[model samples]
Target chain A: MLVRVKSRYRPVAMTAAEAMDGRVRRRERNAALLYDAAAELLATRSLDEISVEEICRRAGVGRATFFRIFETKEGLLREFNRRLTADAAARIDAAGDIDLRAALGHVRDAIIEAWGHAGPGHASMALTYAYHAPERIHDPHPELYALVRQRIERAMASGEIPGVVPASLAASLAVINLTAPVAWTLSHRADELDELSGVLLDQWYAGMISTPKPDRRRNGPRP
Target chain B: MLVRVKSRYRPVAMTAAEAMDGRVRRRERNAALLYDAAAELLATRSLDEISVEEICRRAGVGRATFFRIFETKEGLLREFNRRLTADAAARIDAAGDIDLRAALGHVRDAIIEAWGHAGPGHASMALTYAYHAPERIHDPHPELYALVRQRIERAMASGEIPGVVPASLAASLAVINLTAPVAWTLSHRADELDELSGVLLDQWYAGMISTPKPDRRRNGPRP
Candidate 1:
């Protein structure tokens, strides 16, 4: 004989949780659409020329939705910037644990790949604007810095690298040197960014690893 | 015997030339005064916050003279930036023909000294602004880049450096790395700028010279 058991409405609780998850996913999707629209517009227009209305239109979202996600156009742009930095940081993390040379190469490739989404011209301009803002440039991208510091520490501890420089300083130097060429290429040859970036990393890493004495003879007279 | 030929009105001609020279000098003095005043004001305020009237008042010059020297307030700021870069370049040239280490030291010193004129906060802000503007950041500072390139070429040619990197790429790396640290110090700890800059250069240079095998052990763990 089977006893009749009363069944609890567990499906009701599951439905509520699923609804909450669906709401979150919807919000994320809306924000992503807006970000993508802004990036597309920003690729051709300056920040000043971009409007929230146009972004909403391109994103297929209402003005109310846009406002719910972002406070202002500048705020939206800042969000985009933050997202880019975060994505690059994520890439850096993903590329970690490679040998020093491969690690640097992977990191560079990650940055370039992330930047390519915005196109060279837009990426260059965005970086230029961010650099001029009052905020500390490196503070927004702690992951990248941590990656550099970690690489330097590992290289130092294993006696795999020649430099006696502190990890922090070396990391800073690597950040700047590796970045300048990409900026240079963006200004001079956007199409050649990949090639120039490779050249910069190759030459810089070579110099970093090669031991040589300062020559006494090159104090040649200036013209 | 003094031979007095036909009077050629030499005194009158000399007077005209001297008057012209004096007028030019006065104009230059007025412009310099305006620049100094702007620099002082920019130290404490953003460029947008600075007004033409306030600048003229601080400079003790008429607004007309300010306009005469500079088309707009932005123009004045650009000129100021240009002057600072030129001064640094001039110092780099003056410090040329030294040994590899000394040349780098002198160049670094020259750059720091030139930057020292503006309080660190102002200097850092100015650089931040310059980086964002549409104008090319490196164009106005051609001399600085040339100096770096020249040094690298000399070092490479004389076999003073162990690395076989191209001169141009190496130079870009040097410029970016060196400047980034000074900029960092300005915002983070202005008082310790000199000391921090020295450490940065020392470590970076050491890394550039030391030969090390890329360590393969640390690529063991990925976070």
Candidate 2:
């Protein structure tokens, strides 16, 4: 009984924190490499036609590595969207307590910058993907949706905006207003952005708040 | 010598009215046949997966005949859309001088009815095609777009609405609003046709006339 039994030799299990941290770093690096390649390939061809091999070659990663990170081409596309959406969300979240006009302008400017830097082909691909990927677009990382929704709800609660409209609908409309201009720009009608954004903002604020602007009469002779 | 031409051998072009009528009748017949076949086949397969041969076989038409009528599968799909859009346009146009709310309600009712009559599978296929089609949802049909734009512009002119939001944006939004709800419905969501239609009408009117409603306050409140 005094003698200790010899234990079998075994590898020690990694701590949960260590495992998670390593996994997270690996995922982030792989995703960055994939996106860099995707952005480059997208610049030359439409998304529908771009093959996984091309992306892998461009990223200087093997097929196995690519597959280890992304399940499919669409998965890679979603990753790219996730990053951009997160960036935009961060910017929007940072500008807390701003006026509606200024806040919306900030959102609009961020969206424009994102779209502009996305380059023409990548922008078109992202738009086309968004159009076809309804489920993805609606829930492309629900955390972002939740954050945006909470911010909008908080704004509504502040009475800076007046609306009985459901928070979800208002969020959806804000999204539509922000993205619709990009859809037009993707079609090469870039000149329409300023005018379209103005119209959209006016409609959103005036319609939602039911605020009567005295200048309405100035737009035309009262109909 | 030319006077010796036989009456039976001479080719005769139909008059403009007669030709147009005949063309319409032919189109109607072909569409009915194709629609029936498509509805039946779509129960088990997608439009992309279905072949021209299969569509023709199901329709009891020859491959050549199918091609003669529809240049491609996309063309056939477009024809189906054209029928639906035309029907919607006719209904909307008939409700002349109706307020934006009523007119939109009528259009919604018509669309719901049309969708109701379609088999669930066919409705799904149509939605998929509409989403993926090259043309943005409403623009492919100039006639429909023009009619919708005119109605929006008229609504704005009526001073019942107060802003200069482009008629085009209003028209596009109207189409998207109507389509989005129905598209959502197809997925078996917590949506009733009448309720969704009502929300859409409310949003459209609010957006169009810059009318502030209680719901607008529910959007993010200004800090």
The deviation in Å at residue B106 for candidate 1 is 3.8
Best-performing candidate as measured by lDDT = 2
What's the i-RMS of each model?
17.3, 18.3
Candidate 2 lDDT tens digits, B1-223: 0011111211235566787777666655665576567657766666767888887787777777677766777554454434543454455566664432233233333333444344434544544543332234442233334444555565566555554555566666654554344334333434343344345445555566553332322111221
| CA RMSD, predictions in order | 20.3, 19.8
Q: Is model 2 an incorrect, acceptable, medium or high docking prediction?
A: incorrect
- Candidate 2's C-alpha runs over 4 A off are A1-23, A37-60, A70-77, A96-107, A124-223, B1-28, B36-80, B96-105, B119-121, B127-223
For every candidate, give the share of true A-B contacts it also has: 0.04, 0.10
What is the lDDT, from 0 to 100, of the residue B186 in candidate 1?
A: 33
- After superposition, the stretches of candidate 1 with alpha carbons farther than 4 Å from their true spots are A1-25, A36-58, A70-104, A115-223, B1-26, B36-60, B70-86, B89-105, B115-223
- DockQ of predicted model 1: 0.05
TM score of chain A per candidate:
0.44, 0.48
Q: How far off is residue B87 in model 2, in Å?
A: 2.6
Write model 1 residue lDDT over A138-187, tens digit each, in one string: 33234344545555666666666655344666666654544444334333
Candidate 1 chain B, which ten residues in sequence have the lowest lDDT sum? Answer: B1-10
Q: Candidate 2 — number of clashing residue pairs?
A: 19
| Shift in Å, residue B22, candidate 1 | 7.8
